[model samples]
Target: MTTTSGFLLDQVMVTRGETRLLDTITAHLPGGHCTAVVGPSGAGKSTLLRLLNRLDDPSSGRILLDGIPITELDVLDLRRRVGLVAQQPVLLTDRVAEDLRVGRSELGDHGIRELLQRVGLPVEFVQRRTSELSGGEAQRVCLARALAVEPEVLLLDEPTSALDGVSSGVIVEAARDHVAAGGTVVLVSHDLAVVRGIADTVLVLDHGHLIAHGHPDEIDYLEAGR
Candidate 1:
């Protein structure tokens, strides 16, 4: 399949003051497909997601979004198109409704309700304070907020890491629905089961290097040690 809106990383490298975070990574993230980035801790899976969304620039090489260098695109516009839901949900205000409204004033009450339902939340929760939400609920709210923006690419960084099995399943369904609607999803996860359930393609990272990229079955052996 041709990916007109896919991401291309060419010799991408990220370095901190003294350490290399990611090294010479090259890969293609096809559009309309769910690509999972998996590896042990400190393997730069999250770092790769940040680079894809331009949260930070690479130390060397280029990242292309739909064949256009990301540096050439407007920062705010790029972020809007590529929404990220971090491991921890960061709410802008106390009210769940207010948090969803951030960066998306165009969303009406009906829109907010739909988004909440899409992430398996009840419409009544919109008026509830963030303080009242459990860890899983908060994460789902964050996912709803990200979807509110209608992003072309959704980057999920271990979205269900802190949640229970049922909560994790809800998040997985939300992501699958997004991809089914022609959205591209890049998932950073350590849960092999979750990756196997949703990933169409998998990218394995180790010590900031791209170790492998193939179908889920091709990398299933990575689960042996865990």
Candidate 2:
């Protein structure tokens, strides 16, 4: 399979209502690796990820994938190739089985089983209603749903922010494995510990601009001495 990867932004800016939420920024996410975006609250980390998935377009400048501009792609096709998983999982009116069975019809059953196993869910979850899922269960289901679309790039915005330690661990491992399998992952989180566990590179954002960018070990040492 062809490994999926993309560039990020070139002096992009974002605004909401009357307030400037994100300032001009430029950063390149290395292909085929997990890049962890970390910072304090209101640091514009989540906004950056949303821009990558086109959930919210930039007010100025542009986000590019490869060398092509993002706005040039078809919205539906773009979303299919780029999956977004938020901190609080949202489920549609469908069973867990039907959710994961969305992308391909032939392997629906097998796909659901495999996804559940990958996300640390038991086979029993297949029949469960989306409404009845617990916090951890819901997040895993959301992940499975994202993967069902066969997306090449996954954008996670605090995906484990609402889960317990055990639950977070499962999702972290799932993210790591996906990257290892040639998929690109961009994760936005404030949890340094979580970043240390899975991130290959780290991007520190503050006030909507690129503050620091380097390997996780570099930041780990910097944080240790502070």
Candidate 3:
């Protein structure tokens, strides 16, 4: 699988009437690395992730993937290349297996089982109904489904927030593995510990503005809360 060079946000901004959701945010997410976006609530971390995948377009400026403007790319192709595992897992089908196979028909039963295992889920869960899953279980299934597509860049929005310690570790390990295999990962999280554990670099946002960009160890955690 080919890896993407990375993403570039050049003066990206988003506004809703009088509200500014993002304010001329500019940053570079290096390829083959895990970059964490962190801050207090309503910091626009999720908005940044959504913009990366064209789930929401910026009001101004450009977002580039490997030096090319994402606006010029096909929306469907862009999403497939940059897969997103949302904060809330939205299962498309009733059955877990069906949900995983929705757009990834190339993934067979064996592939599905492997993906489940990667996310610390039991193979038997494949036949289970999506409604029967716990919040954490459903989240893991969503992560697995995203991996099944083998996207070049993975955008995770607090992916482990609903999970237990073991499950969270499993998810983090999967992310680490993805980066090691040449995929780029952009994570949004409030958990400082999770960011420190997996992020090579950190971007701090506050009230829709870029506040800081540095190594995880170099950031002042206290200031990020404000």
Q: What is the lDDT of candidate 3?
A: 0.91
Using TM-score as the yardstick, the better of models 1 and 2 is 1
TM-score, every prediction: 0.96, 0.91, 0.95
C-alpha lDDT of all candidate models, in order = 0.90, 0.82, 0.91
Better of 1 and 3 by TM-score: 1
Candidate 2 deviant stretches above 4 angstroms: 1-5, 103-107, 220-226
Give one digit per residue, the lDDT tens place, for model 2 in 1-226.
2222466678898988787767888778876789898877888988888888788999998888876798999988888988998888888756888777665456567778888988889988889988888877888888988987778888888888778898889889989988888888899887778888899888887777677889987774338532
lDDT of 3 at 194: 84
Residues 1-226 of candidate 3: C-alpha lDDT, one tens digit per residue: 2333698899999999999999999898988899999988998999999999999999999999998899999999999999999999998899999989977987789999999999999999989999999999999999988998899999999998999889999989999999999999999988788888999989999999998898987889634543
Q: Which number leads on lDDT?
A: 3
RMSD of each: 1.3, 2.7, 2.3
Candidate 3 has a TM-score of 0.95
lDDT (tens digit, per residue) of candidate 1 on 133-215: 98889999999989988999999999989888988898999999989999999999888889989999899998998999988
